[model samples]
Target: MIPNAIAVDSATGAPIVLAQAEHGAESHGAEHMASTPGEHGGAFPPFDSSTYASQLIWLAITFGALYFIVAKIALPRLANIVEGRAERIESDLAEAKRLRAESKAAEDAFLKAQADARAKASAIATEAREAVARQSDENRRRLDTEMAAKLAAAETQIAATKQAAMGNVRGIAADAAAAIVERLSGATPATAEIEQAVDATLAR
Candidate 1:
């Protein structure tokens, strides 16, 4: 006969079987043990959806705080520093331009002064040369006037000596003729007779 059930004996730690009443035949029993207290062997509990939502909310709040700090505080300070640097560069360029213009003006003044000095020097030299030429001409005119006066005085002296010598020669000739008449005629000839003889001899 077939057995009707099978069971485990907890106290003896062994399996047991029971037979049917009419023929004593055996059969298979249950495969698994029953559930007990404090055991967790079933499907996991359902996911906590609210826990994930709370975590995401905290992350968003932290990220927004950081973004506000960077945008409002850090970025404006950096922008001010950049603007100040640009203004400083522009001021330096303006100062350099002014210095260059001042240097150019100084150079122009120096060149003008040099030109004026040269012109004055040339004028002084011209005046000195003209003065020397004028003095030389005056000296030459004075010398010529003195030489002419001396030459006139010498000519007058020569003329006076020549006239005196001619007068003495005429007087000597008259005395010699009177002496010749006294010797030849044994007496002095009359002035009329001498004059007639000199005229007749000159005509012949």
Candidate 2:
């Protein structure tokens, strides 16, 4: 069982045992804190005045090293890269201009060549037409000459045939006359006399 009663000290009329224990605990906590003041100080060493100059020197050294690397090495590398890129771009532009000029020249040359070829073809065609026309005219002239010669030969043949037919008619008329005189007069006419008489009658 636990006693729930008030405690009293007979000597000083107070609770001496609990008061002494609380006082001893408070003093012990204060002694522990005073003994470890250096541990707490170490957590924030930069706030300590004893090492302030050394921190400033280290900070300056680190900043100088970073500045040297950036200025001397990294910045030069970046500048070279930018310059090379610019040169490449300029070279590409020059090449493009040259190609464009060449293309234009080629197009002009092709057009000229096409015009020349067309002109040559037209000239050849014109010459061929002229040659064909000349040949046709020559053929017509030759045919006309041959026709004139043929017509003249036919007229000459007709005249010769008419002269031979007239010569036969004269001989037949003389024979017919001699035969009629012999029947009517009982005397035959002389051959020479008959021929002479027929010739004279034809002349009259």
Candidate 3:
């Protein structure tokens, strides 16, 4: 609290101290009135400059302490946490790259296996087709050989039958000639003469 300026009593020519009439306590009465010349020779006690100066100094000290704590301790801790997070992110990215490479390798192996299987299947099919063709060719050749043998046997039988039939026709013609000669001469031919005439007719 501030003290007010004192007013002099002109009639008495002395300093007049205003009093709080009902309070009866000096500390309480001083708070309510101006100071007299008896209280510090009629002047204020430098207006509490020391108190203001002390308050300003303490405020500055507290601000400096708080600033130092934040700059030296709290900021470094925060930086460390940020750095750790960044390192963790880098590690995670590296792990992802490794897994991707493994996946690609597996895919390549699967593709190669599929290609090999297809090639083997194609080869098998070709071999089977070739086998079938070979069997068909062998069957055709066997049938042609059997047919040729049968045709040759049939031709030989036909030729033997034709020769036998021609021999029978010649014997019939000779018997008829002998019977005509006997009728014209009115005599029977001897055995030797008949044999010689049959031979000559056959030769002619």
Candidate 4:
């Protein structure tokens, strides 16, 4: 609110009075028609040269106070918030990297374990195959030995049978010759002579 009287002179330090009638001339009943003398743009009183120093002083004070609030209060709080967010982001990134490394290590370990298991299984399978082959070969050799023994025994039995049959054949031949001689000559041949003769023929 501006008073009808203005205090503080421009240079002489004397009080300046603005009469109510003088103020009314610049208005029509209740509406403003113009601003105070030396002021431009109605309702904007800062353009008045009479109050230029005061306006500048207030402007400087307000600007300084705003600057102080921004520098000392708002800026520090904002900086702290920004720094805290930055640290949190960095921490999250580090944690993510750690987790990724752990996951990669675990994957590598699993792969190694799988490969080892496969190798062990292959070794076991190879050993089993070799064992089976060795067993089969041993069985074949044992069977061959048993068969050879059986073959030898059978051969001995055949030879013995053949010798027995041959012995009976010689006796039959002697008996047949004795009977034939008796029939033809009407006399029986001596058994001793027949046996001797058959023995001689067989020896030849």
**Candidate maximizing TM-score:** 4
lDDT of 3 by residue, 73-126 (tens): 988998889988998999999999999999999999999999999999999999
Candidate 2 regions exceeding 4 Å error are 1-52, 119-204
**If both were scored by lDDT, which would come out higher, candidate 3 or candidate 4?**
4
Error of 2 at 5 (Å): 40
* Stretches of candidate 4 exceeding 4 Å from the true structure: 1-46, 130-204
- Give me the overall lDDT of model 1: 0.64
Give the lowest summed-lDDT range of ten residues in model 2. 1-10
Q: Please state the error at residue 160 of candidate 3 in Å.
A: 26
Clashing pairs in 4: none
- Pairs of colliding residues, candidate 1: 1-23, 1-24, 1-25, 2-25, 3-25, 3-26
On residues 130-154, what C-alpha lDDT tens digit does candidate 4 reach at each position?
A: 9999999999999999999999999
TM-score of each: 0.34, 0.35, 0.36, 0.43
Q: Which window of 10 residues has the lowest lDDT sum in candidate 1?
A: 19-28
Judge candidate 1 at residue 86 and give its lDDT. 93
> Candidate order by TM-score, highest to lowest?
4, 3, 2, 1
- Give the RMSD in angstroms, all C-alphas superposed, for model 2: 18.5
Candidates in order: C-alpha RMSD to true structure: 21.7, 18.5, 15.8, 12.1
lDDT of candidate 1 over 75-150, digit per residue (tens): 8898888988998999999999999999999999999999999999999999999999999999998998898999
